[model samples]
Target: MVKAAAVVIVVVGALGYYVWDYNTSPTGGKAKSEASASAAAEEAKTHDPEVGDCVKVADPQGEPLPTVVDCNSPQAEYKMGEMLPGTQLECASQYDYGIQYHNSRGFDYTLCFTKV
Candidate 1:
């Protein structure tokens, strides 16, 4: 009987803690769920490269995925000149480098870059 009573007391204590925590929390136990969803949505937003932005190339030999960086930073190697939609591109002679990005979903674009 004593062991059964101890187990019941432990279970009751756990339940009491849960009730207190839920009542004291501002969102009543929904804060974590709501915050996680909000954070996921924010992270899903994509960054679009624009003209005049300084970009860094991780490797010229590999597939290009230029990321924007401060022009004054050592990692920045090129200055974006033109951004055109689609794969068919004719970058002007002034641009020193050009990269064509092909999106399998059909939203392709080309980026013209000049040496920084």
Candidate 2:
């Protein structure tokens, strides 16, 4: 009876350890990693430019070019805080510093923004 009880205890202990290890393993912790990856992918797609979107400037001193970056990232340098009607961009508000043009083959040339 005592031998049987010892074997059962050892089995239960081993199962508990396996469960803990699996949950803590990086690759095995699928739910957490997958969620974070999806969130990052969503943020990356936001770089296409929309009002109130934060962006990063490739050249801050010269004619600035903007790229969408995670707003919380250190690389973020500007925010598209507004949308003007025409090509002329007269950013009159705070945080509005420069303009980045989206010139495509046939699409209407739109004026995006950067920060001061």
Candidate 3:
């Protein structure tokens, strides 16, 4: 009976120590790591192309430009962000480019690359 009691005590003590150690760890509990990773992943989603970011579009003018989106009006083409790497851009003549559009993703320099 004494031996069994001693074994149980030791096991319980070890378990308690392990729990304490885990909580005291710099990284903290499972919740912290998961939350941090989730937050980082979310931040990564906001990535926009940079100045040297390239992309592939249907640019007939061979005007190597950055990739982007459209979140502007018809006249003012505000710069958004950037595109991917090595993108082919098409002229406004073919794609009917009017205004350079810059959305949250990136900037499209179609302001003066249109035909009409």
Candidate 4:
């Protein structure tokens, strides 16, 4: 009986230590990692490609995230042409592609690009 009680106590103590260590970690556990990821996504969403700038579209569906790149690079698939004040539907006929960004905070813009 004493052995069983000692084993249970040790197990519980070890588990409690693990929980404390995880919660007190410098990175603040999974919550901090998730917040960092969210911050990164927000930053990516704000990347505005200027006219004539070469960009690489990371995702063409949903909210498109385009990264500016050197025009000569292979990943440079599109060259920005015009920046409209509205959605993708407002793209000019001369532009081959358009990526629109609409946020709840009143920032709405579109980036028109030509396939390279």
Candidate 5:
């Protein structure tokens, strides 16, 4: 019947619209996936602090808030060298090792080094 044919057309049209919308949406389908991938890459870069990374520690005795600085600057407290395990350890030499930790939260690591 004509009504039955009309119903089928309507249903198909609705489905097509939804498919197009999903693909175009910024927070769904391909767009969303690409955005997430970009975010993850940036997060990895932030977490993986490398050697020769200059940082400024606010509190020496308390939990260190190390803000990465230019190694050439006088304010730069430490230049990161090694990646270590756990939270506690002793540096072998006077020029100590800097630690960059990765967790659910943002940069939460200790930079152990003598003053610059």
Candidate 6:
């Protein structure tokens, strides 16, 4: 009988904690769910990191090297190098996103990345 009482008390304490936490947390609000989902959708729509998007490569060697194969703009060509992906790329930090060249460009000129 005493063990049963202890178990009941423990369960009741856990339930009370859950109720208190749910009411106090910011995530408890129904408004945050809709806002979170909308923010997620907007983030998904905006984050399009694709190839052929006019970029300047920021290599460890720094700045554009001499051989830029695909860029039509001299400015874009002037910013090419062996740049890998997910390295915070931009033509410069202030401008829009630069193209992320896939790292498969061998001697024959191709782009490659390990697919997740």
> By summed lDDT, which 10 consecutive residues of candidate 3 come out lowest?
48-57
* Pick by TM-score: 2 or 3, better one: 2
**What lDDT tens digits, residue by residue, belong to model 1 across residues 72-107?**
999889999998888797788999888888877989
- Candidate 2 residue runs with Cα over 4 Å from true position: 1-47, 100-116
Clashing pairs in 4: none
> Residue 103 in model 4: shift from native, Å?
1.7
Per-prediction TM-score, please?
Answer: 0.60, 0.44, 0.34, 0.57, 0.51, 0.28
Give lDDT tens digits, candidate 2, residues 1-116: 99999999999999998788767767665657787899998866754667777788666677666677777888777777776554555656464465645456544334445562
* Tens-digit per-residue lDDT, 1-116, candidate 4: 99999999999999998788777777666668778899998776546677888988877886678888889999898999988786645787888888888889887888889999
Assess each prediction's global lDDT (C-alpha) against the native.
0.81, 0.68, 0.46, 0.83, 0.66, 0.45
The ten-residue window of minimal lDDT in model 4 covers 42-51
lDDT of 1 at 111: 87
Tell how far residue 100 is off in model 6, in angstroms: 21
Q: What tens digits encode model 6's per-residue C-alpha lDDT throughout 10-78?
A: 999999988887667777755577678989987654332234333334451453222223356663533
- Model 6 clash count equals 1
Against the true structure, whose lDDT is highest?
4
Candidate 4 CA-lDDT value? 0.83
Question: In TM-score terms, which candidate is top?
Answer: 1
lDDT of 3 at 109: 38
Report RMSD (Å) for each prediction in the order shown: 5.9, 9.9, 11.3, 5.7, 5.0, 12.1
Q: Model 5: residues >4 Å from true position, as ranges? A: 1-5, 24-29, 57-69, 73-75, 96-116
